[model samples]
Target: MHLAHYLGLLHRSQANLASAFREVAAAHADEPDIEHLCLRQAAICDTHAERLHPFAERYAEEAPREPDRLHSTLFSGTRTGGIALLRDLQDLYLMASECDICWTVIGQAAYGARDRDLLATVRDGEGETAAQLTWLRSRMKQAAPQALVVAD
Candidate 1:
């Protein structure tokens, strides 16, 4: 079943978001609130990843066990926040976007195949990532002004 492909994507998002969350937390350490939030989101991603692991095996399809190649999230900030923090935040937003897309893909596949279990799992994971993305976007809006204002 193509469920393997979907599961692979879910795992990839887990890995990327987990990495992004930790690194973004450290990269934007000046913002203690964001740092704490990323750390918390990372924990949630990890938990969901673990829960989805068993399903991957159950729906094994001999496909490659990786999807980061399809959608890379390995972001080493390009716009170094002051500027650095802003860039990292943008990357986190991108990752969150990817997470949303991945969840949507997984949901469509599972539901189309009438796999209720997979659909439910993906839905729950989607909610967690959505919360993280919503928070990140709100924080980004708050920080953009300070980041753009260059002082003499």
Candidate 2:
């Protein structure tokens, strides 16, 4: 019944995450790996949102008025420099973490509602979201030593 609210939340979150990823990718375009991977991940986020559309519409009638502050901005703009890249990745990790948890919560709801399609979508999205978090974490680790300990 209340699944629609979560579906909407997730849809918007995915869109936001995708946009942030693209922003970071463009800002850090000199980092080839980051640019390519961020763009790829953005596409994944878009796919996740696309998959959720039908479910959101199906449950729209049952959804109550969305509560205020259901959505919050995670990324403002990307920064420059090595340390900035690390910081930007940290921001991304946090955003991806939000998506990860939402996938989990929605997966549970899908099971309760016996929605196979939604569950499948959640499962796939969860894997991609986890990969995004892992990459962000690893990239941060790689950048930290150079950014923090080395003389600029």
Candidate 3:
């Protein structure tokens, strides 16, 4: 597929992932730590979505939306049965993984593009997401094991 197509896909995926985090945060808002991290993740996803908007428009592609319950059901059902801290940790890790995928795709696009501005933007975004993922992973490690939520 073309670079624009790939970018569109990335944008949609990030949006859905962000939506999931928002849900998790809302579901466990009683916990400050979970709420804070989920809010941060939602903000990042919003930024990423905005960045991808122009590309989607330029390519005449529809951006991806948050999946409905049917889509989420394929994964683990709503993350419950865990301490608030662990639930947030799990959500963040999932978000990190989604961000990593976006980074990889954007990095590939940067390599293929001749446009310096586009390349630079994609590369920078990729780097930012990678750094965020690293930070989240580190925090996950430091948190209590029981706080880490995992989905099959």
In lDDT terms, which candidate is top? 2
lDDT of 1 by residue, 65-99 (tens): 44455234347443342767767777777777776
Q: Which pairs in model 3 have colliding backbones?
A: 86-147
Q: Evaluated with TM-score, which candidate comes out highest?
A: 2
- Per-residue lDDT for 1-152 in model 2, tens only? 67777787778778878988898899989986989999999999999989888888888823322211222343544576658888888878877887898799999998999999989999999998999898899999998998999876
Q: List, in order, the clash count of every candidate structure.
A: 2, 0, 1
The segments of candidate 3 whose C-alpha lies over 4 angstroms from its true place after superposition are 62-77, 83-88, 147-152
* Residue 123 error, candidate 3, Å: 2.6
TM-scores of all candidate predictions against the true structure: 0.85, 0.89, 0.72
- Candidate 3 has a TM-score of 0.72
Question: How much is the lDDT of residue 110 in candidate 1?
Answer: 83
Candidate 3 or 2, higher lDDT: 2
Candidate 2 wrong stretches, greater than 4 Å: 61-73
Model 3 residue 97 CA deviation (Å) reads 2.2
lDDT measured at residue 100 in model 1 versus the true structure, 0 to 100: 84
